[model samples]
Target: MSDEEWERFLRETVKDTTGAPVEPSARAREVARRLREHPRQAEGWRTYSPARPRRRKVWYVTGLVALVALLVALFPQQIVGWFGGDDGGQDGAPLAAESEAPREAPDAEPDLRPTLAEPFRGSPAARWADGAAGITVPPAKATGWMNAAQVERALKQSRDFLVAAGLDSDVLRGERPTKAIALLNPHQKDVQDYLRTALSSKKPDPDTDPLLLFSRFRPEQTRLVGDVVKTRGRLTYREGKRGAVEVTADVTFVYPVTPAADSGRDAEVIRTIVRRKVVMSWDDPAKVITEPGTMSLVSYALDMTNGGCSGPTGYFVPPFGTADEQSTDDDRLIDPYDRSKPVDANDGTTSADDDCATATRS
Candidate 1:
């Protein structure tokens, strides 16, 4: 691994091992700089001061006065013997009274020393610094696709925020607005087309009945909590300019749902199957990684398996797809219109397949 990669790995490893997140302290940095500049003295010596008298008594007052007089009078050695100062004035005789000027108060203690060990710098993943939640805003100005990833992440965050505010769950699906509108307004041709493809695509078998089939969907209600970005691209000065790009998504949001009547059963089943939800968000290639050679486009797929609405789920939807797919029990697949001929299993059915020459077309 490169040095940067190694550093990042080390940082992440440390962060994981220690639950406490390491933060950069300006004070720490400054202290470190000072330590490097002015290291600790080799002597490592410290001086002791006499404790101040809490309450003065007649004897204490008299003794203090006598000691001061002796110290000033060039009899410091005698005074040391009389008191408890070991080797007091041993280094040198008290400066001649005339030459000894009052000492200025010792310089205030320097700021506390910084840590001896290296400062702990967290990894980029652990270093995600979100702004105060709920106070985020749209970009102040359009900076072009240079920050496209940031924009998409921001849009998702915004969708989450709106959902938390009780706007609509479908909006956060990251599909397109048309598909979102179609979910509620199936009468629209766009909505009809989506329903036809999603719901009418297939049919179920004779004995078993199921609840839902289309597996992927975007929650209608969600909100954005925070965002940050790292980029390696040229900032646009005018209308059009482009260069290398790198973007990341950092977001957090909440989804509200009423408690299921049979929480245990729902949990078990939801965890087992994946369901689909509609979305109305956009994707910016600069911010998202995708297969090579595919131009950015609306509509995508999501695997809801493990814990979707009813069970683990997954499916593909076009830009304006709807939420009208049928649900069934078991794995039978049949014609959506006739419900007679078997087409596939688990997946939904659609209109007759007239394109097939060998098999009877629907």
Candidate 2:
């Protein structure tokens, strides 16, 4: 082709491939200037044989293909940008090179630590203000028959005291009920003796503590954990041969299970619901009764672990009760009445009573 026509063709090709104005290479511009300055040499190229021209055309096409392949390999992202793709690269820089550039600093992250609620500081029967794991106190009933506030107070006090004594771990592990036993009302001597015997025994003995035998039947590697999530219930006053007030509560506790040694799995948390009953009596006949009057715990009972009360693991022994009547194998009463036992003057007047007695009375 003529020199002028060749130059125009090269310009158009460059513009089409790069989507930009053609800026001819120095060599190309020099060649064009030489051709323009030398008319005789340009004429000779135009007058070449037809077969020779075809051969030259073939070489030109091959060279053009190689140039295009090289440009595609080196400037792929630039080519993509030319086609409106987001390489975010400038001046034909490779995508990888652009990615290596320093980035702008990111904004600081917000704080995300969990905040713990303050623990209960008021009376025990008052609402438990601080409950973890989404636990909440149920609404109090308006009926004044039973002292709901007193019951709540008792439950909170018992739960907190038990937890502090490590009841969840120590009692289940057959360790001595050191801290927890102190909270038991003195009226529950039989129950106390039974628990002490069970904890002290090296092996399950049927004679000392019959209930010890059932410890073997408990689920292996399973133990009680967690705290009281919520409490709800009502109290009823009974006026009969033996006058007393009773409080029944539905208590929820959580337990976390460790993964089995052989199983490659995550640990799980399980919830257990226990029905607790507390009975209070004012032995003094002359004292006038009030909503939250002076009353002593006489009997306490917690439902058995399994479905029915038939299990060897008798229901949770109340903070007060005679072991003979409430814990025997044959006679298992949820709320038994045995007034024969001397009432524990939980009042501070008696040093023989448990220290918790003073706290409970207050």
Candidate 3:
């Protein structure tokens, strides 16, 4: 085709691709027309035009080729990935495998030892409700005065005693009337330390009163089954010339697990501090029974003979002041895993000495 025709064709094609007409300068168009008009002159066109150096063209071509090569090199894996290849292993699953096999939920921490519970003292409802608030007096251990049938009769008669004494009807309605000892604030360390100290010794002081054992709700072990937890406990009381004394206030505490705080540590803090206050209260000499014989009896009741140490296991006990008895939700509640070995409570498996004593001795 003629150079002018070729130029017009180029213009139309450019317009089609770029949507704009290609325009050659007037001088360039005239030159292209003259060259095309003379075949001989067109043949000598390269000589007159003085072609660019071969090295420059080579460099330009090399630069374009290198650019294309670089693009391919940079995304070789991506190119292969478009066609589906192992090199790009379906969305970096290989990279994930190379990094670390998903950190397994860091080995779960070993659970803490489960605590035991105190026996239920009063009616089921009463034991669950006024657990640590009910009053207890020394029970006359006069077996000769009562049999099963007579005890049932006494319990029926006790309803009048309960009303006169301002006790709850639930406490008197049961076949057996139970006395409860509720401790305000008993020290945990003092109770544990006292038990360890007293139990280690065979001959306790006649003048020294027995240590009173009391139990309260531990938030860590407790669960919010419904609105309230059913707690059961036993308190060893003794009487003397002084007054009624709580020799041992060992009770099972049942309460809801207060939810965790926003920081996730509130539950832990509550469980640790709640029982501590109760333990410290029992340490106070002024509030505790001071009669020598009564104290001795309290101590003996908590002694190994009574099997008091082998009480409740894994009972839910939340500390007081954790929450109003009305609040319900597990949002901030503290829950603890039970590590207490399954026990045959029927076979007196509660004795910690029975379980761990051999381990310690060996």
Candidate with maximal TM-score: 2
Residue runs of model 2 more than 4 Å from their true location after superposition: 1-174, 202-220, 223-246, 259-263, 266-274, 278-362
Model 2 lowest lDDT segment of ten: 353-362
Encode model 3's per-residue lDDT on 1-362: one tens digit a residue: 99999999988887788666679999999999987897563445455666677798789999999997886688765555455442312121111111112222112222232121211111122113332233232243423223345333332232222222123233212111223212222233443354444334433332221222222222333332223223222233223323332233322232223332222323232221111001111122454533211112222121111111222231222332433132223333221111122112211112221221101000
Ranking of predictions according to TM-score: 2, 1, 3
Model 3, which residues run further than 4 Å from truth? 1-127, 134-230, 233-250, 258-294, 297-362
| Per-model CA lDDT versus the true structure | 0.29, 0.35, 0.29
Against the true structure, whose lDDT is highest?
2
**Model 1 lDDT tens row, 1-362:** 89999999989887787676588699998999999999975643485557786675878999989889878587655556455442321222222211111234111222221111100011111111122222223332334453545544434443342233222333323333343232232323443454444433343221111112222233332212112211100111212223222221112211112122323322211111111121222333455443222222122222221122222122222112122233333343321112122222222222111111110101
Per-residue lDDT of 1-362 in model 2, one digit per residue for the tens? Answer: 99999999999888788676688999999999987898553346457655445788889999999998898798786666466552221232222211111233212212221111211111121122122212222334322333557545644544443243322454444445455545444444555565566656554233343222111112344333233332223233443224333332222222222212222222232222233334444322334333233344444433222212212232222221111122343343321111122233222111111111111110
